[model samples]
Every structure is written in C-alpha cells, then in structure tokens.
Target: MTTELRNTEFHIRARDGAGAEEHGPYELDIDPGRTADGDAAPRYASLRHASLRILRLPPGGSHTFATGDSEWIVLPLNGGCTVAVGGDSDTPFELSGRKDVFSGVTDFAYVPRDAEVRISSAAGGRFALTGARCSRRLPARHGPASGVPVELRGTGNCSRQVNNFGAAGVFACDKLIAVEVLTPGGNWSSYPPHKHDECRPGEESELEEIYYFEIAPAHGSAGLGYQRVTPSGASSRTGRGTDVLAEVRSGDAVLIPDGWHGPSIAAPGHTMYYLNVMAGPGEERAWLICDHPDHGWIRDTWPDQPVDPRLPLYEAPDADLRPSLNETVEAGPRPSLYEAPDADPRRSPNEAVEASPRPPLHDAPDARPEAHPEDPEGDAR
Candidate 1:
C-alpha cells in the first residue's frame, strides 16, 4: 500500500506480502524534487531537504545514476559493493559490507552532488542510498565501519542500540544526518515521543525524516513491528500536519514531515532495525528535538532500571570488548506490560490497546546495568 496524501503531510509505503507485483530494482524511491501534476500542494514539499532510495541488486549486477543536487551515502544493508564517482581514472571505493543489518556495522561510501556515480556488487546485495539536497559539494569519501559510534540508549523496555554513522557531528556532510537503530524483540525504542519539526534555535530543528525498517524473522515466519506519529499542533510550510499509525514489516517505510513520532515497538520474538535519514533547511546542520510533554517524564525512570540484556547485538569491527553476533545472551521472559492480545498481527499495537488503559512500566528482569551516555545533540532517539 502506497499512501501519497498530496493534501496532507504524512505518508506510508507498505511492503506487499502477497508478491502480487514488482517495483523494479528500487523497492522505494522518494525524491522530493519530483511531484505529481495538479496537486494542491506538492506531496513532498516538506521533504525537499531529504530523499531515500532502496536498491536490490542481483549477483554481479550494477547500477548508475547522476547525483544532481543531493549528496548521498551508499550504505549496504547486506553483502558488499564498490562505489565509483567521476571519470574512469578515479579509484573506486570497495566497501566490505556485512551479511545483514543485524550482523554488524558496515562501511559506506559518500558521493557529493552534481556527479555521476556507479555502484557494483559482485555478490549482489541490498543498498540504501540516503541523500539530502545540498548546495555544498564535498569530496567523495569512505566511512569505515570501525569509526561508527554505537550508543546504548534508554533502559528497561525502552533499551535500544543506535549506530551513529552519518550523524551531523559524527560525520561531515552538508545537510544529511543518518543513523541505524536496533531494538531487541519485545522492546520499545524512540520512546518519550519527540519531535524536530519546528526551528526553535537551540531547542528544535525543522527536519524531515524517513524511516526504513527491517524486522528480523522469527523461526520460519516473517516478523512485524509498529510505528506511530501524531500531530504536534505544528504545520509544515505547506500548512499540513502529520498523523500516522502503521503496521511496519520488512521493506516498509514511513515518511514523517512534521510531527511527534516515537515508541517504535518491536514485536515479541523479532528484533527490529530502522535506518533514520534526515535533513532540514537550518543553517546549522544539527539534530535537536523536543520531547512530547506528556511522555517526557518517562526518561526520568530509565536511570533506576537496567538496560535490556540483549542489546549491543554486535559490536563494531574493531571492538572486541563486547559480545559478538553469534554469542547468545539469555534474556528472560518479556515484561507483562508488552504482552500482545489475541488480535490480528497486521494491526498496530496502539490499535490493539485502544479500548484499554495504558500499561504501567515494569522493571525488566535479568538485565545488566549500563551507563546511558548523554547525547550532546539533545535527546538521543
């Protein structure tokens, strides 16, 4: 299901489970510069700063395109690839990517705007081309996997791991900000509902964000997750507010133009992963946000609780101080607060509990205490 509400701000692109049709090599392609005719307002006006495209290549397949006015990062979701920008004399960058998103942090290649680029994967793989329209054209470069900062955020059921690879201060870019997040099965991340929709100087920056999700399969069945976005009494330049509640599966994507989005919930027995791509019109390329007043108090409870034991699923390539991907750490039964009812799996979690009262936060058992580092860029998602 592709929801392009030209009259509104929010949109969703759900993956087709029935294999009814194909969307070619690019599973999802969102270019704000491209617009449909006769629209009351450009469906992607708020997305003018950021763009995302998911490409799946076959064995020995290659793809080429011009960057135009956007700087992009060729990030492999699985397998490996070579990125080349400019003439044939230029040396192409070889990226030793990982087996999958859950495997470990993978290296990436950055290509500046107004250049021709080519990506070839000898063994085939899936790649995420996260971009942001920018005026400055920086030189193409490679980002080593060992350099990505892995941060453990929140505690208890809110525990999650964040891979700040293309973060504003972490990496150099004209306007792009990208990151990867991993949440253990049955836990919640992106909590304390936050928003970066308004330009309030030191408080918040009006950045549009794109969430690309991949749910780790449980047993032989496909897994699912849930995402929620509610209006924050603020409108985009086009005068449209955002609102969304969707059942997100692997290959699905959610576009948030302006709103309070959070609590990306992972279903039981399934690990959840999301790639966050963001960029805005702010003169200072920074990620600053304001937490929703109603749920902001939840962050206070994290200090007393322990982080989920299953986090840091895997460490960076150079780090041997933490557990590897193959090592299984026992995580006891999930807290009763997250237990799902006997309802349709396709329904959003919020919808499943719409008639009931909110569950109280319970301390997770069998977890170890880990320090929650303060993010210099406001709240850590």
Candidate 2:
C-alpha cells in the first residue's frame, strides 16, 4: 500500500507499492518540484533543501539527467556503474560497487550543479541519487569506499554501524549530508528520539531529512521494520508539527519536516539498512541535533553498558588501500564543512572519544558539542 500526506504536511510515509512509477526504474523520487502539483503530487514539496531518487537498472541499462541547481552523489545500492559528467574532459568515474547493501561499502561519484550527468551499467544494479540544492558549484569527484569512516554507535540493542561516506566533514558538499546505517535484527538504531528542526546556535540545526530503507530477507520471505516520528510541538517559523508511525520495507521512504524521530526498530531475524539524506537552509553545513528530553538520559546509560558484540559490522579500509584524491577525480581543494576546532580527519569516532577528555554524562544538553562524542566530528545526528 503506497501512501503519502499532502501539502504543508510535515510527515510523509511513502510505502513501496506496485504501479507507483517515476521514469524508468526510479522506484521513488522526492524533490522540491513534486510538492507544487497540489494533491496529486507527493506532499514533500515543503522540503526546500534535500531531495532523493532511487533508481533500479537492469543488466546493461543506463540513465541520464540534469543536475539543475543541486549537487548530487551517485551511490550504488547494489552493482557498479560508470558516471559521466558533461563539460568535463576527465574520464568518467568508474564505481566498483558492492554486491548488495549487506556486502562491503561501495564507491561513489559527486557531480556539481547545473551539469548534465549520465550513469550506465554494463551489468544492471540499483543506485541512489542523493541531492541538495546549493549555491556553490564544487568540482565533480569520486569517493572511494576505503575512505568512508565506519563507526559503531550506541550500546547493546542500540548498537548500529554508521557509514559516514557523505558525512559533513568527511566529504565536501555545499548543503547535502548523507550516511548509511546498518542495524542487526531485533536491534534499534536512531534511538532515544531526536530532532534537528530548529536552529539553536550550537544546539541544533533545522535540516530536513529523508529515510530510505531496505530490509534483508529471511529465507524466502521478505522482512520488515518500524519507523516513528512524532510532533515536536508548534513552531512559529514553520507553523504546526509532523507525525508518522509506519511499518517500512524495501523501497520505503519517510520524510521528516519537523519532529522528534526515533527507535527505527528492525524485526528479529531480518537485518535492516537505511540511507539518510539531509540538508537545510543554514549557512553552516553541520549536523547538530537535540535529543528529546524524555529520552535524553539514554546516553548516560551507554557508558556503563557494553556495545553489542555484533557491532563493527565491517572495519574501515586499510590505510594502504586508500587512493590519493588527485588520482581519483578532478576536484579542487575545499575546506571541510563540519570541521571542529580540534577535529582530526585521521581519527576514528571511537579513537577520538578516547583521546578527548570525557565529559560528564549529566552535562547540560545544550552544553554538549555540536555532535555527539560518539559520532563523526561535527555530526550529532
């Protein structure tokens, strides 16, 4: 059953359904343009910054599109492809993608705005075009899988693997921030309910987020998971709030305009994966979130508990395997968007936490750094 809430609507739950089509194998497409078509269109138009499209290609298939005013990343969900960008004399980027989301991390390509882009695959596969409207036209580049920082977040059942491939400081982008999360069956990620719907200096940044999910199959049957988004009260700037509670499966996507979202629960026996795409109106490209007061205490307990043994699903690539940025793509030197005063790109999330002085668990919520100590530098979501 495919469902969508329309106009000024804050929460949108898009379930995968037969007959839901969007040019070729684009299972779902959410952009600022979709919201202008009134009730007939998907009610995600209120989203001004972030956009997402899921494309599935058969063996030996290809697709082409214009970037317009947004920068985009061609990320392979499964399989590999060649990304050709218009106006560039450089050779097209060759993404040696993985077998599936459950496999190892995959490489990606970033294309600047106002350019023509073509993606072709000799052997068909699925890809996610994650995008965000922006002003600067950064150079097109390739992101190697080995450079992606993999972090294990939370403890016990909350344990999950975070692949910070397009994370703010990890990759250079004008307004987009994207990452992949993998949760073992029966565990909960995105826990303790959090929100980034307001700009509160160092506390939170008002970013719109999209959650696209894919559940691993159990034997011959499909698997499922649950997503929750509740209102964060009325806001003077955006008016009302947002709300949603849905069972999500493969090809499912949930849009969050303004609300507290959490506990993305995976059913037993079925591992879950979700790609998070985020962007906002803020000039500073950082991800700062405020946890719900009711659940904020959960962070305190993590220090005492042991992380689930199943964590660190996979390790980061060895240093020797990492390729030089100049050899991979033709990109200019750009400062990191989410750099902290003392951030070290070379350190892992866990290593950073160990190196820094531990803050008291009872510290005032607003006093915490822009990002959780356990997350990549400058990222709290």
Candidate 3:
C-alpha cells in the first residue's frame, strides 16, 4: 500500500476520564468535546447524515426531537430514558436505569427523514441519541449462523463475535467483517501483536479495521487503557514497529489502516465493549487477516479459556427470543409489506430480527473455541 493510504491520528484527550461519570440536565451540552472518550463534532461528511447528540435530562423530565429524513438509535450512556417514538401513548418503549433492560435492545430505530421522533425521561438523566440518514437495506438472515460462531479465549482477552459480510442479507459497501466484542474487567481484546494488511492461511481478510469503543464504568469511576499496534515486517527490530498507541475510552474510534494491533488493556477497574468495522476491495469480501509470524502460535492456546461474560442474548439468556418480538410480523410469509420498507410504508422499525436469515458460506468451516474462560494477562507473548 502507498504511504498516502496511511492516514491516521489519535486525537489526545482533555483529561483522563474527566466526565467518566456524567452529570447535568442540559438540552444539547454535547460534553464529550473531542476528548479521547469525550463526544465531539464528527469529522466525517457522512456525519451530516447522522448527528450524535448527548442530552442531559432532569430527573423525571423528558425531551423530544421532531424528525426529518433520518433514523436514530437512542442509547442511554449513564442514566435511563423512555423514548416515545411515533408518539406511542399506549406502550412506548421503557428502558430501565442501569438495570437489565429489554424491549429497547435494537441496534437502532429507523425513523424516516419525513416524520418526527420524540424522547423523554425521568430524574434528569444523561443519554446519547444518535441520528443517521440510513438507507434501509434487506435484513440479514437469522437462525443458526452458517459458519460456527467461535468463542475465542486469548490471554487477558475477552469474548467476541465475528461476522464476515459475505453472508446474504449482511450489508457490504466494501470488504468488511463486522465483529462485536465484550472485554471483561482486567482483560483485553485484540492482542498477540498481529498484522493483517496481508492475507494468510486460515485467515483471509485483507481489509482495514476500525474499532469503535463503548465503555461501561458500571462499577467504578475512571480507568486506564491502551491498544498497542505496530507495523510488521522488518520494522519491529529496527524500532520502526509503529508510531501508533491509542489510549481510548467510550465513544472513541480508532482506524487501523494497516499493521499489528494487540493488548487492548483495560484500565485497573473498568469494563469495555467494541464494534470492529472492517472493509477491503477484494471480490470475496472476507476477513483474511495474517498474524505477525512471531505471534501466530497464540491461536492454538484459546481452547483453555472462555468468552467474556458480557455478551447479549435474545432467548432466556440462552433461548432464542426472535419469535417474542411479534408472532404476526410475517417475516418469511410476506415478502412485500414488512419485507420492503420503501416499496411499502416503513412499518415498526423495531423488532426486525426475524426479517431474513443469512446463509452460511461454508458447510463445515472452522471449529471455533467454545465458551471459554478469560485469558490471563501477560499471555500475549
């Protein structure tokens, strides 16, 4: 790759975990303000299509935003809120405060750019409501994932989900493998100091990765964290391993244009979550990453560990909850109404898990590690 393709930066933070615990009841204070973990004005043009706004509501108080040609995901960062989409006077979705909440577990809600969507809450809590000009695509297939959903247990690392976009219904603007992960307290995520700019055996992703962090200080205030990434090849021994070391926090995004990344170290007392967005220019549209030669051996040691205990589930924490969304949505029966939103009217954008099931690319692909125990720290060697 050309050096020009190496565009990257780690916008430093104003202070370490300054607003780790939010406080306020402002309309649009937008407190994060460019801090590493702090929310700030987005630099991407697409952001215009999507506006991420943080609202601080007074206890028992509420707020609303009339909609435009846009959809939104209302996420409560610290406090809880009740989002009344479409002015549902009867059963608007109610989200619990720092408690196990159901009903509002959607990745996001689809609101047309034409209608108005509203939000409300109690006790003036803090919440994040992100807006996006979404072009609704066909929902991905549900049911059992075709390929085995592996349970990776790396040293000091936690559990994670990896989905190659090649599966039908899975969106693919480029070669991107969407991976979600939950890093436990005292654990890490992307480790082993591996590189993937080049394709390799058992690993075939040739795309760049973007890590979007979501931290939960559910138990304490503030934390220490860092992601060690370096350039592979001759650069390691010559000290040119890399010039990048990102100290991230919630809301922070890091772009891995190329190189080896590892040891996503959690601070002394905090938990973390991340969504990995990958994309490349290959026709196969797969995740073909190659590990640094010195570190490929680590994958063999995963069977001894377990997944981080923070992943989401639809069924009774172990059962499939897809059918509970609604019995009459007619996921497979009607291909026109609930199937095509634009062809018809945008039905309830919530509970779309039953739309379609993605096909497994390979019949019997790789044998993924089972639910594993958290790996030990300093095991990334």
Candidate 4:
C-alpha cells in the first residue's frame, strides 16, 4: 500500500482500477485494464471477518473462485448472470439482474463457504461480491427479486426505499448481512444516527459495516451526495473511535468501524443508492443498534408527516406500483401512524412492531406522533 493509501481512514475513495499503486486492504475496483487476470486481490482480505469485491465482466466474460472460509452473495449491480457451483455435479442457477440499482430489486445467488463457483454474464454486467468469514457451510441458493421485501421508510424528505433482500430475519446467512437503500433526490436516509458497534447481548451487536454508494444524476448531468459518521463517544475495546464526513460519488465507499452513523443525504436533483454489507465477531447474526439520543426525537415527528410519493421505484412483476390505501389512510385524521419504538425513549426496544392498534381517530393538535409502526428503519442497517 502506498503512503497516501495508508493515511486515508474510513472513507475509501474510488481509484482507477488499473492504477499501478497498490490499494490498501479496504478498497478495490475491478476494472479490466487493471486486473486482467480476474478479480483484484480484495483490500480487506486480511481483515479477520468481512470482505467485498466489485466484479465487472464483458459479454462472455466469466470469473471463478474458491470460497475457502467465507460465504458470498453474487448481487448484480447491473445486468443478468448465471451462477454455477461444483462444476458438472450441481445445477447452475440464473439471475435476472436489473438495469441498475435504481431500476429495481435484482435476484441474487449465494455461494456457500468451502465451495468452488463460477459466475458469468450473457450480455455483460457488474456485481457486488459481499462475503463474510463463517463456520457454517450453508447450501448455495438463489433469491428471487420478487421475494425481496420493499419497505418505505421515514416521512416526506426523510423517506427512502429499503430492499431487505438479505436481512438477518428475512434471509438466512451464516454471518453475512446485506441490504440496499434508495434515497430519492433531496431526501435523507439512515437518519437518527445509530450504531451497532457494541455487543450488549440483547441490546446491540458489534458489527463492522461498509457503505458502497451509487448516485443517479439527471440526464446529461452528474450526481453527488454526502455521508456523515460522528463519534458515538464510546470507543472500541481497542481504544479506537471512527469519525468520517465525506462527499460521496458513485463507486465511493465508507467503512464504519465504530460510531453513530447516519443522515446519509442525497443532494437535490440526484437520487442516491447504497449497498450495505456487514458482519461481526458475535455468534448471532443480528443487526441490533442504539440510536443517538440527540437525534432520536426525529422519529416522533414522522407520524405527523406523509411518506414521499415516489416510493417503490420499481415493483416486482405482478406487484402494484401505485400508492396503497394504507399509506393514504395513515396520513389522515387517524393516529395509527406513529408507533415506532425509536420515536419514544420510554418504549422498550422489544416493543417495536410491524403493526399495532390504531390510535384514536382524534387527538390533540399538540400530540407528538411517533414514527411508523412498520419499523422501516429496522432492517435498513
């Protein structure tokens, strides 16, 4: 690693895939010009747990790997592909990838630990190889895009879309946990500043996360956004604290080792998408977090507001893209809208729910409504 690469912390800026300088063990761009052999050596390969790789292949191009101790998911960022495992012995599965992250949810294939696999695209594609060191050798399987749950979170400007494709409760994985978040132009996601860096048994889990971003711009223009991670005032057992504030562009990545990270903002006129890959030393693959007390009040204000109108960007086939009656009903005179646990510090974490009793039809105008009861922020991390 060059001196410059070594000095930069947390946020990993994009680099020419073919650059001669070695990228430190935190970022890698799999461009054809740079790594003609195959996927570049993962920058985080030496980190005891999580690893990520971006793969780009031309039509007819293929990449193969031996899964050693890490299980991986083949998530297409763009285009379709085929996943073949165990050579002729096992059947190969196909994934119908979307045109882009913003296009819609895409099917993904999971490759088990200690296996041999090959991934190839028919027309050409880019993929995110999200991997984590694990002990269980789970079966390789394909997840359909239609099955991925699409969640609309926050209200108005804080609203965003979350595709819970690989959430802990949604999909079974040994240690790898991954999800995608889409913030419309001028919106904010990952609000209330939360952290999962401590292993507090039933309270929180210690997890390291990577935020890989992609910004969508208007036609003939560029896109930009910002991300912030403030110190949570609690240091890791190693006595290190993470702090980062970055201007992120497409392909940029941010590493969250410890902190209250949030308020990922999409600049006006440009939508932002980010793939979150996480894992930790804990035995249970849970994504528990603690909201920053200072900003936790933001959740209470959501029930009084309406969700952004441009949600569910691309519904699965046979799904309705139109706004549901539930959303409209929640925005009305009823008080059923605010029931999120984070909205009230008095509410126990275990009290969070998907649906709760509808509040009285009428309440005082000063009533402080809680966030949506559906828990849109639950699996987003």
Q: What is the C-alpha lDDT of each candidate?
A: 0.74, 0.74, 0.42, 0.70
- List, residue by residue over 15-84, the lDDT tens digit for candidate 4: 5342435532223532112134544234432144666777777898888877777889889999999998
* Backbone clash count for every predicted candidate, in the order shown: 0, 2, 36, 2
TM-score of 1: 0.79
Local accuracy of candidate 2 as per-residue lDDT tens digits, 119-162? 99999998999999899887788787766767667766777888
- The sequence of per-residue lDDT tens digits that candidate 3 reaches over residues 1-381 is 322232234322332232525323333222112435544345331112223355666667776665443344455545565666553333254544333212112222223344445557665565544443334322212222222232223422543333221211132211223434555667666765655554553444444555556566645565546776668663344443344677777656555546677767666556665545444444444344445678656655554544343433221112233332222222432221111011112121111321336232233322213211111221221
Candidate 1 Cα lDDT to native: 0.74
Task: Give the higher-lDDT candidate: 2 or 3.
Answer: 2
lDDT of 2: 0.74
The C-alpha stretches of model 1 lying farther than 4 A from their native spots are 1-11, 14-24, 35-46, 88-90, 236-238, 319-377
Task: Put down candidate 1 lDDT per residue, 27-127, tens digits, no spaces.
Answer: 77766775357332364555667888888899999999899889999999999999999763433888899999999999888888999999999999999
Q: List pairs with backbone clashes in candidate 2.
A: 58-124, 59-124
Among these predictions, the greatest TM-score belongs to 2
1 versus 3: better TM-score goes to: 1
Worst 10 residues of 4 by lDDT: 359-368
Which stretches in model 4 have alpha-carbon errors above 4 Å? 1-7, 16-47, 319-381
Who is ahead in lDDT, 3 or 4? 4
Root-mean-square deviation per candidate: 12.1, 6.5, 12.4, 10.3
